[model samples]
Target: MLIANYLLTCGILQANAASGMAVHDDCKLKFLELKAKRTYRYIIYKIEEKQKQVVVEKLGEPANGYEDFTASLPADECRYAVYDFDFVTEENCQKSRIFFIAWSPDTSRVRSKMIYASSKDRFKRELDGIQVELQATDPTEMGLDVFKSRVN
Candidate 1:
């Protein structure tokens, strides 16, 4: 468990270079730890409007699984998450991939969607090791079937 005091200033999160939202350095640090060290199941992130920057919202325990990861995304908001995905390939070999998910539920506000959409690439670029990118606007869009399909 890390004692996080992360908050980004006006840096990343600008798709068109007209906005001020940014990603915290801790976000990239945590991602590196997850990518290189396998330290977390997933990391949830959100933009703190008051601060106008992206910040870490939650960290899944090392023992947590995919169900825990899917459940952690809110029903009516936008979020960014990184998940360590492990699977068995057709050749009976074990493999893992780092997935970056943009969870923007349909029920979320229009403004929220806009902000998340605009900032996604910048934030994604900050985390350099993500292997797969998934954008989910509904539950069915990101189900196990979808995950499996995208893995290959």
Candidate 2:
């Protein structure tokens, strides 16, 4: 009876740990979605932990010229500048690919930037496509003049 109770308690603890991770991941994804919404129209279709990615299906065209819009922002307001570009997925011939310019939360300078896509295939495809451009950049690294020249 004691052994049974101990096993049951362990099971409950494990379940609680898993639940906590899920809740934490959900909150992070929701925060990213909110940040994306501030600059562009986005719909978060899925968030997968195993995949280690968030899949956002863009709802409509970007509100303003992508570069100009990001460039015009005040440094302290956003955590990351997210950009969406086009790509061809196997399931859907063409889809939007999202990337993030991770910022230092206080300074808002680019820490790094990366393709925040759904899967490996999409990430590879984006890299392969020569014409694909970064739709977002650090306002500090590339000023408005340089950012304008790089936009697609």
Candidate 3:
């Protein structure tokens, strides 16, 4: 009961107040372009552990693809990302979906993973209009097939 009460599930993430991290104001402003203005294809975020804040790591241009989004994440670290994926339905129509991804690669340190996992919910709630939420711990988990499967 104590563990359940401590880790509250918020939307697609678990909220752990232990970290007490704050979401930087700029994080939302940047997401607006991707969510409303369609100016960005993706946005990557990293936690400034020392500062106890989440900050934007990178913003993908409208011309960027899913591949670019995946490549932006470091091989041995954990990060958060948002991607504006444009897909065509069987009806030959164009549609787009915004995805919120929590990238916690297995190679990352235990402490680092714990921090990211704990802070994820606080950071994710700052952005609006995320249609899909994905938690990936390996490169294979972030592949296009996995994305396609989840997109539906």
Candidate 4:
């Protein structure tokens, strides 16, 4: 009788485990669907704003056809590509500029370039340093000029 009871308990545990795995798979599928839907909506909005043209001009054009632009976008650690350009200012301050190309996964071939600027601080935290000088200078035209140069 004890052996029969043990076998029954083992079967019940296996069944429960299988059900739990099924539930986990279903939840994962739902999450991916929701995420894809959200990304699609965002792409549509960006297209309406003419952001696609801006991205294309910055990146020089996508290697793949425009129809596959969305599929070319990076996911997680798989970014499309990155380009970095560093320059020295008149005040002897060093700054790094980065451009990240993000593509869509749909038929629109929509793309965008995310730009970033950072001052290189070599001496940690010093008051009279290059980083401080860069912060004090106006950065209005720096980004625009850099972006325009990329298109050419």
Candidate 5:
């Protein structure tokens, strides 16, 4: 009887650990969606783990003009606009930000990154491709910025 009780307790603990890992995994997926939507020209993503925020840094001084954008994400089943940025740059310059998600005890450290595209159309297309890739990915193969180029 004692052995049976010990086994049962271990099983319950394992189940709770599994639950926590699932929650963390979901958070990572949500963060990825947010990152893909934010990609644009003259910007890159720098993921920071310490603070739970995405920092949008300007790529030097804007030479020509600034373009504004609003990025939305689903949080708690309701859509929220997480970022509104007035992005400025020269013809081929760039910017970057780190999108941080809190650490979970059950899962390894996870974060998301956004890369700005030089061409608006190309950025949109890249984002679309990222969406497709996310849909088809399993947990083993998920990675950040796989389809994006780093700014020079």
Candidate 6:
């Protein structure tokens, strides 16, 4: 519940850095929270030590179980209460897990999506489609389309 409340208050700030490779301080802090919460089902993170940056995308599901975390933040639609974690490996390999759990203002259940062991270059390449989708409304989600419009 604390994590959900924290995420609601800090969601907007995290969205700002979502599009860019740069890490947000609040997001970094969330990592600490997640690290402590990882027990069985909440444990979703990856590490890649050979890339220039590490990235993690969030799911739109509840934080209680794997089946509950299957929501993928839709390509361009901006959903409230979206949260994820990002961290760089010791060698800067760019390995980390990301989950996005969608919720209503009341924190009601919604879909959630997740990904792990993603490298910077590979993720960006894959994000090309996501960028195209975000362009219509969530231009900020793509970070200048660094991955380009290859998806379309």
Give the number of the best model, judged by lDDT: 1
Per-model lDDT? 0.83, 0.36, 0.82, 0.26, 0.26, 0.31
Between the candidate structures 1 and 4, which one is better when assessed by lDDT? 1
The sequence of per-residue lDDT tens digits that candidate 3 reaches over residues 1-152 is 45534444422223433544788998999998889999899999998876778899999999988778888999999999998888887788899889899999888876677778777787777887889999999878778887777766
Give a tens-digit lDDT track for model 5, residues 24-140. 232333344545654332232222223322233322122312222111121111111122123234565454443211111223221111111111123223222232222111222
Q: Which prediction has the highest TM-score against the true structure?
A: 3
**Could you estimate the TM-score for every candidate?**
0.86, 0.28, 0.86, 0.19, 0.20, 0.24
Query: Model 5 TM-score?
Result: 0.20
Judge candidate 1 at residue 61 and give its lDDT: 80
Higher-ranked by TM-score: 3 or 4: 3
* lDDT tens readout by residue for model 2, 42-141: 2222323354444442322355455554444445433223445444555657655444333333443221111122122333232222232333334555
Per-residue lDDT over 1-152 for candidate 1, one digit per residue giving the tens place of the 0 to 100 score:
01111112333323332343778888988888898888998999998876788999999988998899989999999999999988899999998988899999999986677778767888888999889999999879888788788888
The better-scoring model by lDDT among 4 and 5 is 4
Candidate 3 residue 123 C-alpha distance from true site, Å: 1.5
Off by over 4 Å in 6: 1-20, 37-63, 72-152
At residue 143, candidate 2 shows an lDDT of: 44
Error of 4 at 87 (Å): 1.4
Off by over 4 Å in 5: 1-20, 24-28, 39-93, 101-152
lDDT per residue (tens digit) for residues 1-152 in model 6 = 45444543755223222232332344344444554453222322222223323334352233444224323333423232222333455566653343322222222122111111112234333321111212222323333232223221
Can you write out model 4's per-residue Cα lDDT over 1-152, one digit (the tens) per residue?
45435534755222222211111232223223323332111111111122211111112132332234333333321122232334566677775433333322223221111111111121111112111111111223224454445433
The TM-score-based order of candidates, best leading, equals 3, 1, 2, 6, 5, 4
The runs of at least 3 residues in candidate 4 whose Cα sits more than 4 Å from the true structure, single-residue gaps closed, are 1-79, 103-152
The local lDDT score (0 to 100) that residue 27 gets in candidate 6 is: 36
State the number of backbone clashes in model 2.
0
lDDT of 6: 0.31
